[model samples]
Target chain A: MSAEETVSQPNPIEQFELHRIFPLEINGIETSFTNASLFMLLAALGVVALMVLATSRQAIVPGRIQSLAEMLYEFVANMVRQTAGKEGMKFFPFVFSLFSFILIANLIGLVPYTYSVTSQIVVTFAFAALVLTLVVVYGVYRNGLGFLKLFVPHGVPLPVLVVLVPIEIISFLSRPISLSVRLFANILAGHITLAVFGGFVVLLLASNGWSFLAPVPLLAIVALYALELLVACLQAFVFSVLTCVYLNDAIHPGH
Target chain B: MKMTIISPAFAAESEQETHETVGATGGEAHHEGGFPPFQQENFAPQIVWLIGIFGILYLLMSRVALPRVGGILENRETKIASDLEASREMQAKAQAAARANEENIRLRREEAQAIGRDAQQKIANEAAAQRTRAETEAAEKIRAAEARISAAKTQALGNVEQIAIDAAASIIEKLSGAGVDKDRLVAEYRNVKSS
Candidate 1:
């Protein structure tokens, strides 16, 4: 019984372990290179390779890869235009990069034995922080003190302003936390669940007379993987869409 | 333990303090650390790399890749617009050419009809003139033939009187057995004819 327990210990969380690839101290900061950095680089490079190399021909009639690139471009472009309006196009590059990176990171993580960069709260928080920072900075720079009107919605009764304004502010303050946590938790939970099911298959096969039950967890993992793939894509889309919504507030606040 | 591991939310909360302590001790202790994600030591590196790589990606997208795509799309739009304009112009020109051709056909048909009418009128006039000339010549020839017959008839009548007198004198000579004077006979015949 002890041996079996030791052998089938639910080691699902072990996949998230980060091993430092290159140890570096930057101005006494422990900014060592790790698996997360490698995957982030891969995701960035993947975006660049797709965007840059595919359009090299610049065909009047697009090839398949070029079509894919254009489709992604137009998808995000239309999303930004619809959500944030026409003037919101200035943030197209930022939105595109955020969307593409998160999407690719999620997909790469779905691969067995690959580290999911977006699974880290620090990485997702960095993205959320970046988006929020841009919103506040650009909002103030463009709209000045009127940016605060985002909290003070229009056409509300004076008595309700007391309740509504604080709620809006609290929600506004919670945006980064929610944004970062939503993505991190989704990816982390998906990977953990997959690992858990996968662990079941191993645990079942290791036991006497229970090996026949191994295929059940294996089948469940296959199904869950498909769902996780959908979740991965959905989470990326949600993140970018929310980013656009917040930027819309910056662009056209108060209403 | 199994339930906690399966439920990541619980695991994250329950394991945070242990992971932080393990992070502080560092090195070999990380393998046995609780919930590697919540470990504090990993934040700086991931943040730095996220910033650095994300910055690079932003630059690549904004400065290089995006413009090329926009250019391709804009070029396609302009090409379609220009193509449509050219086709429209061609159609208008073709319509104009067709109209001109129809007009030419109408004019030529009218000219041909006019020529045909003039030829018919000219032919009728020439036929009438030829018939008039032929009738006149025929009538003149018939009148001349009639005049010649009348002259011949007058000459024959003059000879008929002399011959008849000669015959009457010859018969009287045979019957009376006497010679007759031709001059007296002719005078007698003349007086009889006048009577």
Candidate 2:
């Protein structure tokens, strides 16, 4: 390896994980509270507090906070009702909480020194698994063994069953994996890009000449940050809507 | 099918390159690992956390949020229905009041027409009575004038007869005086008559 190349390259992943806030080890199992985890927990609590405070009064003519709260409430509520029907309303609070939590986590990450919990696959996977579990348990509870029929498309030839069933099951199982990876990858890539651009600015300025070229990357980073904000909102919405759709399938399994 | 073969080869090469990059950095630090730290390796805690949050959320939605919204909508429906009933009642009352007013106006007009007819009859009777009284007074005055004229005509005829008789007697008396010697005159008259 060339000396200049070695000097220029930095470990991006290490830099991303440097701010580990808590360290704990117990028995053979060690669980540490990461800065990312801390921020996510705080964001979740903040969302809850804001929702509660905004809705506690229940004014006929809503104030700004109350209006915001109601808009979000109705947004998720309508999504559930439209996708899942009357039975889906029962899932409104869960879907709403999930949406709010993920939304806040994504937005809070944009702040300096705040870690984005959603960038981690473990976090996203957990969210996806919970949704999947709900779909399964609820589907079986509602439809009994008939819930397995979800894997079998109707009106297909019997001879196709052998090929189709396994493919359907694999596709079903892949849902959580894809759902988690989509969110994690998007957030992780955005943050890494921002960091690299920032590092470029630093390196250019430190080199003392040709520093003016740094503005181009800086401008790009700014634009990317704005785009990330939009993505964050979109991803949160997509996640919540998909959850609603999955629950809808569980409630009414045909089509 | 042929393209698929090339795609997998390209993907494998990309994966290998990524691993090599990771390995090259932090050489001894990377080598010292049996597994990455539990923080890095274990996905269990996150799964547990997400499941727990979702479970709590589901319970809250089923128990709390939905019921409140349903109640609000139901209450609004009841309120609107009651308000409509009240307005209908007010409308009915107003219609009844208007009907009563119309009936009163009709009765009043009939009463006024009856009173006008009675007044007109009384005025016509008074005029007829006045005309009859005037005719009676005129006839009485004519009768009294005729009686006075007949009495005056009778009196004038009696006066005219007395005057004529007096004048005739006086002429006869004058002629007799002129001839004082009546007996002598009578002898003479007898003579003359014989002649």
Candidate 3:
């Protein structure tokens, strides 16, 4: 409140952190339900409920909600089929659910009062770990030890295996890290950009002298929000599609 | 094998970029906390949670959502096939009806021709009988007219004979010698007429 305390530049990364509600402590550990987790859970449930309600009363000629439901189904189905072929159908439900969950989470975060779960490393890592687990387990199950052949390069000099194998294993293990980072970074960056633009508009308006110029930042924020909506859906789709591709590699390990 | 090796190499290059970004961000958070900050819940609980979600999702999808969708698709296919079969049956029935109708027309045409032939034969027979009857009746009428002319001719001949005899007697009385010969002349005329 002091006159000497000037307005400082906002830290975009800290702005993205989920603020703890009730600030509860359990055995000296932070056990509070954060806003981000709450919204993420809500988004997941919302997606499930939407799909159920949309498809429950499936008419011979689909109504609008049913058509939308079918569209989402067909979209994910075709993506899987394209990426993994007939083998993909076995993974259809998982991929479709993943796509819907991420899509809904992203869209829900765009709401003013909601937090984006994908912006959090923990949440993204959870999804990435699931994908990586399936890839490893299913790969070995389907192909057995032959799955190890995936690390060995074909038509290469045998001497090069020394250099290639370790690099390949490290790369394989890094799948979850890269997957998680891609989604988390995109969502986090987009939100931060929007927040910064919004802060500019607020600061401009508060200045009063630059009230006329406030519309510029406000317009930029609106445009960026729209862009963010697109990016949100795109990132979800990219994540799901990449998971399918990885599953394809697991099912048929070599080529 | 070649793709597998190449793919991971490509992925690693991208991973390197991500690590660099993470490193940059991690440095900024160093004052608040150390690099690779530990969570309140360790990896074990997080793994359990992940596994739990995966299991539930797997069950929901495999048991519930998949079957519902598959059932809908199967029902649609069955309905379409049944509809198609029903239409095919209708088409076959229509074709059979059309063929029966053509057969009926063919039979009626043959029957009509037979009836027409019978009518013509009946008319020909009646016409032949009428012609024969008329010929016979005309022949009888001609024979009766011939008989009536013959009778009239005979009666006229007898009257002429009597007139001739009377004329001959009168001529004989005009002369004594002729009178004596008139009886003989009339007798000669009667003999000649009889002959």
Candidate 4:
């Protein structure tokens, strides 16, 4: 057992490990530039290249790239309008950035040997925290303490209020946790599952009798990879949609 | 088979030590060996980059890209609306022209009917006047001819009687070698004719 442990271990989790590319110190914090930062930069560049570079022509009739860029803009714009109302359009930029960033990051991460930035809990949590912070700030600023009516139902008995208010507050407080973890966990789980299945294929190939059965896990990886691709885009959409919903709550808090 | 089954947890520890020692040399020297994601040393950099890059993206999107896209969409909408309006105006103009053309045709048709009726009335009046004139002229000619015939018949009758009387007188003279009185013979012939 001890001798076998020293040999090649099928370590799927090792894919997520970060190594510093450039050690960065800002004031005193260790803000070293790592693979995650690289992908994040790539994601931002991807957005700029698509949104800015693709639309330089500004044609009356859109070509393919312009059409694609316009479609994305309208899509997120409509989402914000529908979920958050016309007034919610104020937060359109923030929501659009979040959606595109997560979408690109998730998709790029699916490519082999690239880090999935969204898989990091801190990154996803930061977005969630930002969303929650904006909601509270905007909600209170716009509606004042009347925003607290979000927890207090309009037509409930006082007895029910005692139970319902706590539930509402708890659900409200858990928004960031759920929002962040949902994206992070989905991406993290999908990559880990793919890596594990990939490791199975490698291990099966190395074994003598089981070499022929390696195609099974390889097929499984293929299926899982497809699922992961769907998840990547879906989670991005879900995150933005949830953000819109929360912002809606902030805008009109009586409900 | 056993190696594959037992490796994830065991491999994580071994990977952790290597990463930690590497972390010690690197700036993140306070690293603990466990799950890579759960490790505290990696969080700050990812968060900083996320905030920094995300902020830049937000700025680019809000200031530049979105406005251009919105302008494109708005321009297309206005163009379509104006095109539709122009087409509608053209359609109205065509309809009015057709209405005027129909009105013109109707007026010409009524004028033609009125002119035809006037000609028919004029021809009827001329025909009636001609008929009256010709009839009056023929009647006058017949009356004159009748008057002349009557006069000629009367003269012939008178002459016939005188000739007869003379014939009688001549016969007597030739037979008896005597001259006869014309007035007496005429008177006698008249009395005989009367009787």
Which candidate leads in DockQ?
A: 4
Better of 1 and 4 by DockQ: 4
Mark the regions of model 4 whose C-alpha exceeds 4 Å error after superposition: A1-8, B1-32, B120-195
* Tens-digit lDDT track of model 4 for B21-137: 222212121224655666778888888888889999999999999988888889989999999999999999999999999999999999999999999999999998899899889
Model 1 earns a TM-score of: 0.79
Question: In terms of docking quality, how is candidate 2 classified?
Answer: incorrect
How much lDDT does each candidate structure score? 0.85, 0.67, 0.69, 0.84
Candidate 3 lands at a TM-score of: 0.69
lDDT of 2 by residue, A147-240 (tens): 8888888888988988998998998899988787778767766765666566566556666677878788789889988998998899898888
Give per-residue lDDT, candidate 4, residue B127. 96
What CA RMSD would candidate 3 show?
8.7
Worst 10 residues of 1 chain A by lDDT: A1-10
Q: What is the TM-score of chain A alone in each candidate?
A: 0.96, 0.89, 0.88, 0.96
Tens digits of per-residue lDDT for model 1, A1-255:
001223546566677888899999989788889988999999998899889999999999999999899989999999999999999999999999999999999998898878999888888988999999999999999999999999999999999999999999999999999898889878877887788777778778999999999999899989989998999999999999999999999998876
True contacts kept of 2: 0.14
Candidate 2 stretches with Cα past 4 Å from truth are: A1-15, A159-163, A204-209, B1-39, B42-195
TM-score (all chains, Cα) for each model: 0.79, 0.66, 0.69, 0.82
What is the Cα-based lDDT of residue A87 in candidate 1? 90
Answer with 2 or 3, whichever has the higher TM-score.
3
Candidate 2 has which clashing residue pairs, if any? none
- Candidate 3 on A154-184: residue-level lDDT in tens? 7668789899989989988888998988887
Cα RMSD over interface residues, candidate 1: 3.3
